[model samples]
Target chain A: MNGVHDMGGMDGFGRIEPERDEPVFHAPWEGRVMAMMRAMGCVGGWNLDMFRNARESQPPSFYLTASYYKSWEKTLETLLLERGLVMEEEIVASRSFSGSTVAGQPLRAEDVSKALKRQSYERSTSAAALFKVGDGVRTRNIHLPTHTRLPRYARGRRGTIERVHGCHVFPDSSAVGAGDDPQWLYTVVFDGSELWGTDDDPSLKVSVEAFEPYLEAL
Target chain B: MTLRVRALETVLLEKGLIDPAVLDLIVEAYETRIGPRNGAKVVARAWLDPDFKRALLEDATAAVSSLGHVGEIGDHLIAVENLPTLHNMVVCTLCSCYPTDLLGLPPVWYKSAPYRSRVVRNARGVLAEFGVNLPPEMEIRVWDSTAETRFLVLPMRPAGTEGFDVDALASLVTRDSMIGTGLPKLPEVGP
Candidate 1:
């Protein structure tokens, strides 16, 4: 979507100062927000990609100014509003007049650990990969208005395939309520000069995982 | 912000859409049970055992899962090792996609605009701010976690730790070291 969230090379933001002894959450609300997001995932209507799109699709002002959990909170709100899980007035009133119609069992406290377990996105495919290791390729200059893994900086740039990560769910389609639509994933490496105009450091390289749909034969 | 979150929670709870007990459990797990200490243990085991290191470098998912360190956002894991002539770091340019199961929630700096926008373009400069001054000749590889594949930088062990056990070595494996922003703690500095 070319949103401000796709921040790669565009600069002018100041230096990074790592906090000393940083806590898991800055406030109690942050933790609750995180837990709420995870718990909402158990509701089963939307995928992870949809949650991310809701957050990234926000206005630049909100995306930039909102803290991490604040973004999650907004994303949760956006998802709930869109899914009709809760009404706007209900949120404002901080209570529910009518019950939600969203289908899915609530995540129980006993099943929290199981719900938190990692789920594999890698899906088997009968098709062969278009590119292999050491193959030269160029990233397709795709600028979709939907969620995509292809960063703007590497779009249309030349790179070498480093590794084949097997087929995985394509975010572009998944974000829009499409099915798995898994594609071959590869680690494509580009020289620093290839990504940026010039490289001050001689030995600098950048790499991104490119799906088959985001690549073209060079 | 707090009130908004509380309000949202209130609505969800009143609507019977989510369980409050589940929320508390999730929060408690991340707060007390899971974190970078899990990644540190993995790194320490890899440093001590060559076969495990090779397995980790080959297939990090199975390796970490074998150690029972498994959770969401960590299903597809990749471990990039740092050497004398080579260094690797990770960033999700589009968003804050980190290995939450291994490192708990990402640090604020990782999700901030400055780190996300600059790390790929000026990793050396970014690392410098993190007190990591790599040699000019050494190659720097910046990994953008643009996909589901999460990354963990297996930082090189510090010198003069010949007899250190896994626990002792894990102490030196700081969270930043695994993120490739800083090297492991030196022996004299202590864990």
Candidate 2:
């Protein structure tokens, strides 16, 4: 099984193979939905279960502000049409879902699903936290996610107490619906020799914050 | 302020699930409303008082709140003083935990993985990046702020500034100096 240190390989820091190119974006409506949820104190409150259930089961979900989504939906539809990723008829059909009926249109679920998946993947992989404050720990030398803050040169190194930043929500695989959970975070301070090996400058030190799960106390 | 969240918003938009404009409004609200301004006052106070400086090294949050800047984290804070013999630097290895009640918003570089990962591993090197070159004999104590405790650095008083009042001294204590990047220096007075 791959470990944290293996991330360098995916990003060409080591010998692991990289994944194929993938770009992701979100549907214009999702932002509005999340905002409205947040305004009701539903995003980070006890109502998480309610929201999650709603997200999974509800259709015609409430949007935060219709005006915000209106312009973005137009832009996204235009882009999809321009890229030939969606047919003119499909755009009209999607618009009709928002209650805007266009002339002579039909929709294909496959095309819309593919576009949504791509956008989701992009959002999920872009999260960067690998550590946090006050964690006594080390970095693993593996890669599995889309983006990481841990560097190739500092993997497997030891470090000490730093800060404990509050949970900022996990973006990595979670953004892509891979089940990565949000974690308490910390930053570890490592000595130069530990990260760079002997002959490295003795005076140097590096500090990086990773999630609680990313570290094992040393 | 909104830069980081906007980046998140962009990702959501790219996913074709969320609208960028809505994310923008949410981010704007967070940046302006829920932002941490209390931290700036403590940082400002640290620059001005000597006794407070002493108090800060002994206990950070209290010393800060004594000057009227309490934080949302840590019920009690432990301030690690940076002396000529021992130098202390703060970082949030897990995320971006900081003594925001004193320092205000963490600089962008502080939030970057490079600073967070590298600072603890090679503290001296990281300090150098901030233009702080520590002597070899001096022991560097890197404080990892996890859990409930928050930390701030009480830098040594600058030379050539003896007898300066608290307000005058505080002006010299810039955010960079407090972070250990630069030392407070006396501003040249007009002739």
Candidate with top DockQ is: 1
**Alpha-carbon runs more than 4 Å astray in model 1:** B68-73, B189-191
Task: Report, to 2 decimal places, the DockQ of model 1.
Answer: 0.76
Q: Pick the candidate with the highest TM-score.
A: 1
lDDT of 1 by residue, B1-191 (tens): 88888999998898777888889889889889789998899999999999999999999988887885443345789999999999999999999888777887789999999999999899999999998898889999999999888899999999999999999999999999988888999877457
Q: Distance (Å) between predicted and true CA of B43, model 1? A: 0.5
Give the per-prediction TM-score of chain B: 0.95, 0.68
What's the i-RMS of each model? 1.5, 13.8
**Candidate 1 colliding pairs:** none
Task: State what share of the real interface contacts each candidate retains.
Answer: 0.86, 0.04
